[model samples]
Target: MASSPSHLSSGSDLEKREKPLSELTLDKPAESPYLNDALEKRVWRKLDLYVLPVVSVFYLLSFIDRTNVANARVAGMQADLKMTNHDYSVALTVTYVPYIIAELPSNLLLKAVGPNWMLPTMLTLWGIVATLQGVVTSYSGLLACRFFLGLFEGGVFPGLVLYLSFFYPRQRLQWRISAFFSCASLSGAFSGLLAFGIINLDGVGGKRGWAWIFFLEGIFTVLFGVVSFWLLPKSPAHAYFFNENEKNYVIERLKDDGATGKDASVDAFSWREVRKAFMLPQTWILGVVLFCDGTVLYGLAYFAPSIIQGLGFTAARAQLMSVPPFAVAFVTATISAFISDHYHCRGLVLIFSSVMCVIGFGMFLGSQSHSVQYGSLFMSIPGTYIVAPTLSTWLANNAAPHTRRATAIAIGFILTNSGGILATWLLGALSPAPRYTKATIVLLVFSVLMVLFSALNLGYLWDQNKKKRVIREGMDRSKEDPSLGDKSAWFEYNL
Candidate 1:
């Protein structure tokens, strides 16, 4: 087996790529003196500077385009299309069907083609579809747009998660993942502000105010997608912004961090790894958490304007009021993610977030005062948005090799968009406007479910870790089995 030094100091291609799967070394050497704490921090900071801003804008735009239907509804798309309440609900649900089915394959293709090409291409296609939503004269036309939009947007979020794993180690991923994911919260704020301004163009170009909303945002998205091709690099090894030494240092940090565990022998795509992801207990448990949390997350994002308007504000006032809760969530979500990373405990932070969500939803359910219900919106978003990034990071970190991690993330999001479908149908469409009693009750129930599932995941991971230790005490080092991946006696799951 080769040592760590041989791998880090090799030619431009990663040394791990050159080694046979069976002969790859598992231990990471101690850091060299030249790679000091200050220097390492500087490198990570520069990397963050390059990565976070670019991806964040893409995430922001994608979210705005997806959820802007709510804003359009407030400005009058439903009446213009002659759609009933249930029809609107059905429209919301339609998107997730293709969104769920396309994700796994999209991720696998990303592994083949790389993010540099795939992500931009998808964004541009989705953007064109979003822009066409403005021209759809009939309900069927709207459904077609929604379905195709879902197909294109499906891969982007999970693809972002898998792509980040290429550059960051498992333990260091939480905050960086959160940094980009926080853009979802920011999008809520931006969309509300944009809606407030765009709704004034009620008769522009012989189109309604809602049509302008779609037209303007979609145009911006198309332009951004084209620009992303130049901004996003294929991998750290091939990053254009980095000097040769910086590229070497970045890859080396990631390799060193893999020493403790979650190291699989095969770096190439494997069918075995993909199958193993389906069988892992954590994947389904996390999926349950995702379903519960996503019920609230997308509920708020897709229906916040409606919910707030239902709370007694005019449609215009509701558009402006939707801004603050999500703005606050953007800050709290980032702080909670860093706290989880600092403690190296994902499930506990997840449990805390779920508990906060329960309180938020409960307040909305029980209170008659609109003021108290509005205050409760603050709790809803921060609590729910925190789950997506943290839960994805936890699942991706525990699953090994590229293919398994990709598969697990895709499956988890299948459940998430499934929850989104339930949210729109249960909370928005079936329930009456203004008093959304069903909305509060449904959100409250899901919040409690999230808490229970998070606790179960915590206990399960702890028990599994204890079992691994017991096995480690009896195992022989010379007979170490790399094939076990995360199940190996020496591997420890970050709780």
Candidate 2:
């Protein structure tokens, strides 16, 4: 193991290349104290250009493939399949059953097989499934396709969150993750535009407009997946675009933030860490928060089209109307993320976002006026879209030892995705329309509950940070153990 002093020193090319995986260290003893602005800028530019775009594109397609069923419903899918209202809801629900079940195992596989291979491959499989959705003629076929689609799609979100932590430091992470996650909102807007165009091809091959939506989007996803397999780096040290110096800078930079536990040199998996993950209260706290957030987010994604249509527009117009709110959400979410990174506080933002949801959903429930209800959607998007990236970043910042973090992310996602199941059934059961009063009320309750939970979690982190500071003040430097890493007294939780 490299000691603190060893970390600050630079190694020769021979040392760098010859260093064994088990002996790899993230020390920066030889690094310059002054900033390498040009090199740093280039590194970020490459990441923004190469990494973020591919990841964002993958997620954009994922969201579209996952939620396009809602768009399909209004585009005449239900009538074509002769789906009862309950059958339509059942199709959505079936996807989540496999989705939630696969999350933990999929994240574990991400570590074992490597993200560059696992993520894109998963995308390709789901793309095939999504395209096949267009060919399904009956409710049973729809259910089967959805189940397999969910299984393939399950790994991407949590796996990506875990994969990203390997690259960015804690302070710099949320915005980048937010930037990637903003794709979901962008997808919402883009889905409408794409659907609008595809719907025009309604009789192009004797297929309905909704079928065309799935078929074309799925083809696009497959192409992107092939591109991603070539584009994505395996890890910081393995980045083909970076030289030795840049790779070292990347490693040292993240290690400085105590984020190197699962570096390229570390072992792939650890059962001990998996057990420890369950012991962290933050894991469950963040999971509960995600459950609340996921409900509103998926609820919006799965039903916004229906909601817009009920406001007195034709199906086509409703699809077009859905574009603006997500566009606004993209903007609002980006702004909120920048502020969150600037202040290094997720809790305040979490509460603010939840309040946005409460206000937006409340207005939707209370107001009979179409314009007011529609305006409420603009407020709701920022609220729902902001939570996942913010809260996921918060959990990523705190969870440690790569395995533990992966497990925590998997658990949180599994719980959160159950919210997807809830959203589908709730929408199906309440079957509210024109106002969707009952569903809106349920969303409001969850949103408010999230606010309370975020506040409590915030206080808990603050108190923990305070306690760690006290422990650090009294601890002897020589007696301190670097192996403890995030468990060390010097390791304070980022609020």
Most accurate candidate by TM-score: 2
For model 2, residues 167-221, the per-residue Cα lDDT tens digits are 8877778888898899999999999888888888897888889999999999988
The Cα local distance difference test for each model comes to 0.83, 0.83
lDDT, residue 15, candidate 1: 45
lDDT of 1: 0.83
TM-score, cand. 2 vs. native:
0.92
What is the TM-score of each predicted model, taking all chains together? 0.91, 0.92
In candidate 2, stretches whose alpha carbon ends up further than 4 angstroms from where it belongs are 1-36, 262-268, 481-485
Compared to the true structure, candidate 1 yields what TM-score? 0.91
Give me the displacement of residue 58 in model 2, in angstroms: 0.8
Off by over 4 Å in 1: 1-26, 29-39, 259-265, 474-479
By summed lDDT, the worst window of 10 consecutive residues in model 2 runs over: 28-37
What's every prediction's RMSD, in angstroms? 5.0, 4.4
